[model samples]
Target: MENVTGLVEGEETTAGEAEFYDRLRPLVASYCRTPRIERVAVIGNEPLGSSEERAAMVDSADLVFRVNGFRVDELGSERAVGRRAEVVVFNRGVRPTPWFFAGYPERLYLMIEPGRLLWENPKLPEFWPQDLGIVTMPNREVVLPLGKALGADPRAGGQWATTGTVMLWIATRLFPDAHIDAAGFSFVDAPGQTSWNHAYGDPSAVGVEHRIDLESVLVRRWIDSGRIAYHR
Candidate 1:
């Protein structure tokens, strides 16, 4: 893999190209252990309608993954969304909440900046912790192939995969043997819906950068193929 420097612009001391791959190697090994991960949960930010059993299942998974701006305690009840987040995947542009950084050191953070493939530099948010190491997915290695698989036309304008889809893709690739469960993902069902119903904040409109129609098709294919088990 080629090295891309300056993950956070103007902050030269933080881990750049070398550190990213260094961290990724061990992280992959840790999850892809012998006997394999029994169950892996990829929790979306959408509300779970306070289903206690569903939330419990998410918490019980061997690995629980969450996306940007996820809320656990703030949700007030474990029924809305589980309280376990071992891995957090976010887009480079996301401005995560304070609670999102609560247990910063312990969680595995992966930033997906597909723009980096175009030689674009990433600038971290002011709230980003300086000590945190950045483990970014290689655009050519992960993003491009994934985009192609989902029918993305790189030649087209502003067509990119959402962070949630990227997280699911990563989980499937890394833990091939584990049974993957996805919860709170309502986009596929309502591709025409403009706003997002999150577990934490008010509803926000979908961004122009993402093509929900394209993602919905891919996700539906995954569900039908039994690659991942979907939960409301």
Candidate 2:
């Protein structure tokens, strides 16, 4: 498929897409309301290693974000990774479990498709739950700017940022005044690790689409600049 900044062939904006944005604007407005978000926590799928306080800290945040395939079971105990998920960010390729879809209408769902930078409309996954309102990030508005911030060149293939990183970027952009913290990320420590230690499943090899080496540098830069308070 050809990747471009404008609409791809055979793709057209639809009413459903308009409705999705309509639902999104209000949710964003609510977050940006008076008193603003004081603290924002972004939780990754990695297991929380030996930190008894991580879960409590995550739950205490005014806004909590979790990425694809997140779980709250024994594998992802409340004592380890927290219980609240006010914002859930997922990629189109994720094969999320039933628990990932729980607590509907109460949480904000945002789908990030870096591929949408090459195409216009989003193709909903077959497993996506019906009747749920999800806001799909616009490529030009979200992905492109983020890619540039990470020093990614569009000419360089296979450099797409992972959904977790994009979620963190989104949190920083939407709630600029909020104190942002993150945990359960392993990229900084194990950038070359070939497989994932996801909270919900057996280890799986990392996909080639993500350049973790680049992502690690950006994340470390964020930590160093105090843009994010990273916990192990």
Candidate 3:
């Protein structure tokens, strides 16, 4: 992400690129137990700058966005991220963007319980996942309790379930008493090709953790059948 975020001198490598092979190696091993993942695409939030710059980013994402074609300027951000990444890597919990900005301490302080603090904060209500956890606020976008400056813009994904959503703030829009009743799973990791690190979300919570496990399998059949693929 240092490279992607332009944090490094010149351009080195995208953070997503560095983590790609290692992330899938374990998942494939636990599932296929042999090499299957060859090519990978590490993507980030849509670029925001000059028209040419944005166009270039869109062009490069052709392989990365198999489900979404490069949209024309006539339209706008459609469900934000286009799709839940076939594979995503989050930066874990520690947010670095706040420190860079001025007056950050006042942005994220929590007085009540973390949950209470979240709901009470005027800006943070956007981060709450809703529709039975079908959606959430985009990274860097949730209005922090103390931090009024949002680090990232809220994003949405198009899914069959959300047929008529009104594009409300999802990340900070948690239910006032939304704690679950069931016990959490004991698995070491989540099961999916998608993965993330702190940059994508809080590591302690589920956002940035690598979305794969021993049972996690990237089906080669999906590729063969022309489903769930990059570089079509």
Candidate 4:
């Protein structure tokens, strides 16, 4: 991987993207309520150690952020990542499953590609029963650096950061004052072991849009800088 150096820290955004983001800021702030959160737990789908301990730690946070469709069963099993998710992150095409709506998150952060609009999707429900707020993903400004670092246009989609990594990035941007703790994300797999990527999906058919190597590179950079606390 090439050195990110000055790029990741110096994010440059076009005026249009900046204006759209500025309009969205108030919405996010209203939904998030407090600008300076104390702590947050961003849960990933990777297998974790001591599920009970991890769950306890996660639940103790001021807010819990879960990615994709991760769920917890009985609070002590491997399936139990966290009991509650205050913020749920999902990609553009992937809507939240029934379980996600039932969990009742404070906000649903939809990560969209550059030219795509969520309202245009036919998959959106006619009415959201939970009365949840919505926040667009990638936070363009925050993701700009990562995209530049990886030589990929996040808005164009295809071969970008994994949903887990995106959620991690969102947490850092949305809750700037919060100390973030992440569980269940092991960024890389050994040779020939790449098949076992997520906890629920069929390994061999896990799809290629998620660029784990690029995501891993950015993740390692964050870990090294103490930006996020990772629990493998």
Backbone clashes, each candidate: 0, 0, 38, 1
TM-score of candidate 1 relative to the true fold: 0.82
List model 1 lDDT by residue over 125-176, tens digit each: 7778899977878776567666777778543554678889888877766655
Span of 10 residues, lowest total lDDT, candidate 2: 1-10
Residue 222, candidate 1: how far off, in angstroms? 0.9
Give lDDT tens digits, candidate 2, residues 1-232: 1111222222223465445445564586464323457788898888766456887788778778889999754454337777778888998878886668887667778888877555435678887778887877876556665676667753356367788988887776665556787887788788898888887788888877677777888877777667688886
In model 1, where do residues sit more than 4 Å from their true spots? 1-25, 28-36, 73-78, 117-121
Higher-ranked by lDDT: 1 or 3: 1
Q: What is the lDDT of every predicted structure here?
A: 0.72, 0.72, 0.23, 0.59
Model 1 local distance difference test score: 0.72
Using TM-score as the measure, which candidate wins?
1
TM-score of each: 0.82, 0.81, 0.19, 0.70
What is the C-alpha lDDT profile of model 3 across 13-80, one tens digit per residue? 23553343234334322322124422222223222223443333333331221111111222353322
- RMSD to truth, every model: 9.1, 8.9, 20.6, 5.4
Where does model 2 exceed 4 Å of error?
1-26, 29-35, 73-78, 118-121, 154-156
Best-to-worst TM-score order: 1, 2, 4, 3
Model 4 clashing residue pairs (backbone)? 114-155
Q: How many backbone clashes does candidate 4 have?
A: 1
| Model 4 misplaced regions, further than 4 Å | 1-36, 73-80, 95-98, 105-111, 114-133, 138-145, 154-157, 189-197, 201-204
Question: Where is model 3 more than 4 Å wrong at Cα?
Answer: 1-57, 60-195, 198-202, 205-220
